[model samples]
Target: MNTPSAGTRWIQLGLGLIVMMTISSPQYVWTLFVKPFQATTGSGLPAVQVTFTLLIVLQTFFSPAQGWLIERFSAKGMIALGAALSGAGWAAASQIDSLYGLYATYGVLCGLGTGIVYVGIIGLMVRWFPERRGFAAGVVAAGYGMGAIATTFPISDMIAASGYRHALLVFGAILGVVGFIAALGLRPPQLGETPEIPADKVASAARDVPPKTMLKTPLFWLMFAMMAMMSTGGLMVVAQFAAFSKEFGVADALVFGFAALPFALTFDRVTNGLTRPFFGWVSDNVGRENTMAFAFALEACAIALLLAFRENAYAFALLSGVVFFAWGEIFSLFPSTLTDTFGTKHATTNYGFLYMAQGVGSLLGGPFAAMIHDAAGSWVPVFCIAIGLDLVTAALAWFVLKPARRAYLGVPVPAVPALAEPLAAKPLAA
Candidate 1:
């Protein structure tokens, strides 16, 4: 089999992005339909929240299966199926009159579809762009976030013009068709069975550690914790931004929805893609520890601004940009950190396990924020919790990750890539 050239890899990246745009786009911009969905169904806030909570739960519940499915059918077949399920679920959801119907169709069926496609793109991108995994992963993942800017208005308009059910059917059909087309373009690298070259001239060594042994390592636990902390706060914001804005005195909820504009979405995509290479390379050169520590610190600051100074719209927008950047960058950096530490022999499976951390984090985060808001009448405590978690993560990254990267690189603590005085580490950015 002929290997895809670098240009072909870029094409795969575009297809992966399109899949993200079609299926994974709705999660962040869910706020757009909350009011309308509630109005149509006569449901309360908790009921509405439960629907989305159910969506996250179902999506997370199926993560392992999705990962396993990717390995079995490969990326193309699985994501094509995902696209069909997602579109069909949403379209069916639009016609539902009861909460239960919505739950099964939108929450479970659609969630399952999302899980399958979402796993495929990430695993596919990392394998395809072995030379630039972080940047490639970032570019693919950024589609999920940026997609909202394009879909939000149209989806909202569809709901308004044709009602929610029609909107769902239309969107679902479009997603299904597009997904099928893109799936045809998906293919794994054709590198045969050759092992990757080492990052240094010292020669690449393979890990003899079994999966169970690697899981038992303290580094695995720490990285899981890091991913969870970085994600929960961001997802909380994504899930609740509509309600949060209303509480914070923004009269127009659509303004918040429309904030998913080209500028905002482009910022999200560009920063996320840029940061992957920037920080991954930095992690390669400066050490994953220092890069993560810096990311954690920056994220903490962004959370602080959201909590303390969001009374102003401009301030909120500025902080939103920071939040998106941090969110995108953190997502990109962790995989690079993992592959750097663990090597790539079983990269897909290992990354899939770590990806479960995001699911756990989102599971805990979405409802927790709502429950807190129900109790406290503000997002203040939620923001505080996120900030505190980030600070602890920063400390952990500073100490634990630095040492782990050393062990993985087979170097002394003082000689870790980021810590070495001469800092002449190899560039993994490109």
Candidate 2:
């Protein structure tokens, strides 16, 4: 196959972003649907909450499967399948009256569909910008966060005007159309299509270690822990932010959910997405450790503000922006760090394992935060917990990450063995 032009590569990225973006809107906007769905079915809070919780549970399960598919098929194929399922799930969900059917279709099926698509999109972006992993991944990942910001308000309005079932059907149709079109545009870069490097350059980059050897290193564990901690805080925000704002002071908390959309998208696309590339570029020079340390520190300051102030809109906005921005960078930073510290041969699998750590962190964070709020009857404790974790993340980034990057860069040739132990078996390549 002929190599794709730079423009074609970018177009593929954009299309992948759009597809991923659509898959996310339903999940993020769940609160809007919850009340109406309850009324429509004459079901109580338990039923509605179960639907939401089940969706998340399904998401966690499907992530690994999604990663597997990306290796076997191209990003486009996986995404197209995912998109079709998601659309069909939502459509079926709209027609269902029983909560069980809702859980099976919307909760299980749609969640799995989105999970598969997410892995493909992230993998694709990392491959496309191998040299600028942070920025490229941020741009694609940001589409998820940003889309919530962009769609939630208009979606809320539609829900109010047309009722929840109708809103879902309309949205499902839109996702189907947009997702199908976008999926058509995805194509992987052929080998040698990537930028060229001379033989001497490759030799000079070699190291003493072998592939799969790096798994035994302390550096890998530290990076994994650091990723887990950083992700915990961000996932906490995504899971609880709407409920937090709604519970605290906002009269129309749902409206504020839409309101927060702007900051979510802008901070992700602009601060996180844009800054990620810049940070990754800087990592090439100043070092990944230093660049990530700065990002983690930035996150600490944001979390601190939330702990210090309670329910203040401005404080909430600032904290939310920081959370989104840093959250965007976490995945972006990991791929390059893995490629640099390990090697590109197993980059995708390594990334998948690393992402599993993130998923674990998120899974832990949601319930942990809920416990804190339930016991304390306020979000202050939750914020305090996040701040503490952010501090740990900062320290890990500064100490462990810095030294690892230094060692990686100092080596003339990073042997595949040196990379082996540090990486888990990775997902398939984008």
Candidate 3:
């Protein structure tokens, strides 16, 4: 095979971002399907919400194995398979008559499909952009966050027009096809493509640490806890935005001639997508921990204010957008930080373990939050709990994650061993 040029990585990055975008609507716009699902099955809120939880839970919980499979095979092949499955899952969901079938099709198939593309893309980016890991990870993750923007209004309109089944069947196929086409160009980095850093260097903390060893570190567990909390607040909003909007009496209210629910969802998608790359770029220069503190603190404040201004359609629309802005950065921040600490060789599988936090979060944020709402007849307690998680996780990032990562990386390289050598080692770039 010919040597991969330096500029080729950019092309790969673009393709990865496209794939991420294609897989995104299944997760991001799921709230749009919640009510339709409930009406069709005559199921209650908590029960309907289980589909959302299972989608995320399966996506995240099985990711370690998915990552390993991607690593062992070709990213291009795995992604194509994943895209097909995800798209078909949605289309199949259009024909399902019962709740269990929804769990198997929309929940299980979509979850596993998206999980492969997600983990595969993240790993591919880190390998290709060793020097700009934060930016690379952020950009692809931004695609996932932002992708639903293109579908939110259309799907809402579709459901209003022909019903949810037609919407799911049509758009599901579109998303899958687009992702499959984009993934044709994606694969592992060429041997000489990634620059190498000395394991002992304090500035460039690059070493190929395996997944098994990484799991034993206290540092890794701290990250898991922090990620779980951050994922909780954001996911609660994603899965329940429509539910709470109706409950708070803002769903049908107008905020610039658009219904508040779809409008808020649209705005939230934009901010959520933009924050990943923006914060990732900032972290590249100012440092990751500081960015985490600032972003997490903002998320906590935004959530608190969103609840306070919940009654006002304008506040609900805008503040909810701000809430997402702060929350979405975790996708970029955690992956980059993990790569910084654990090394690039096993970025996919290691992040898979960390990504399970999102599954933990989906449970806490989805059915559990809905159960709280059904019992209390309010969303206030759920918001309060989410706020608490954001605040505590933010503090942990500033006080715990930052120092722990630094101290752990500070250890002498001689104490550590590489799981596998770089494909080709070269001196670090200045």
Candidate 4:
């Protein structure tokens, strides 16, 4: 394949963004279905949320293998298949009334489908814009984060007007067809096709590191630990936001003249989407560890403020957006940071392993958190725990991850942000 011109690469990014947008509704808009599913299935909140947990767990747990599949098959074909499956999962979900049926369709099938599209697109983006991996990844990640902005309010209204089933059937087929068409346009960059222009701020691995070696390193695990901690708090909010909001008395309350739940969701999606690219671009200039520290700290504070003022409906709505804004950048930050640590050669599979941190988090933050909430008789303890995790992870990013990466690279700890030092990864052992 010939080197795609600069414009051609932008076209590639745009296409990936569209495919990303299509799969996003499943994860982001799920809160809307929780009560409805519960009413129909006669299950408790925690049990219904098990469906959400399964969706994330299955999506992430199988990612390493999914990455391998994409590497073996064509990225475009696999991605299209993933999109089709995701759409079908939603459509299938529309017909089901039982908890187990949700487990099969909404949880298992949608998880697998979205996972492939997510991991596949990130893999391609890292290679396509190696120099701007952080920014590129963030843009597409933003698509996933923000994709539901177009759907949340409408889906909420549809459920009110018609029903969840009607809403699911219409949107499922639409998102599936759109994602499939866009995925068809995507392809991996040929060797020497992508630019190698590296700024001092945006670092790259000196050489491509395979998944086995990447897994064995303390540095990778450190990143994983930090990501897992961060993911726990973020995933908790995403999966349980509606539940907690209703308990706080903001779900049906009006905020800015719209129902607080859907309004906050729409606003949260915007901030969530915007943060990915904004932080990704910032990381491209400042440094990944530096960026993580700032964002994570902001997240800790956002959570505390959210809970302290939960009784005021406007505060609940607005502060929830603050929480998401601080939380969502991990999608872009971690993948770019991984490609920078390991090489882009196995970016997909390497990220697949790291992405499992999210699965770990979904377990902790999803059903487990809900169980905790039920046992504790309030959401206060859950929010407090999430706050603590955010602060600890933020400290690790600057003090721990910074020094760890520098030591792994065998570079002296400069007074500067350590990982930002020039990196020349050692070649893989023969």
Evaluate all candidate structures by whole-model CA lDDT and list the values in order.
Answer: 0.68, 0.66, 0.83, 0.87
Q: Estimate each model's TM-score.
A: 0.84, 0.80, 0.86, 0.90
* Candidate 3: clashing pairs of residues: none
- In terms of lDDT, the poorest run of 10 residues in model 4 is 421-430
What's the best-to-worst order under lDDT?
4, 3, 1, 2
Q: Tens digit of lDDT per residue, candidate 1, span 21-116?
A: 787654655666678778877888678767776777666556656766777666688888887888788878878877777778888877888877
If both were scored by TM-score, which would come out higher, candidate 2 or candidate 4? 4
Q: Which residue runs of candidate 4 sit more than 4 Å off their true CA positions?
A: 1-6, 34-48, 95-99, 156-166, 246-254, 374-376, 416-430
Residue 394's lDDT within candidate 2 is 76
Best by lDDT: 4
**Model 1: per-residue Cα lDDT at residue 211:** 44
User: What's each prediction's clash count?
Assistant: 2, 30, 0, 1
RMSD of each: 4.7, 6.2, 5.7, 3.0
Cα shift from native, residue 219, model 2 (Å): 4.5
Q: Candidate 3: where is the Cα deviation over 4 Å?
A: 1-6, 32-48, 156-166, 195-204, 371-378, 411-430
Model 3: per-residue lDDT, tens digit, 170-209?
9989988888888887878868876653332223344667
Evaluated against the true structure, the overall lDDT of model 1 is 0.68
Best-first order by TM-score: 4, 3, 1, 2
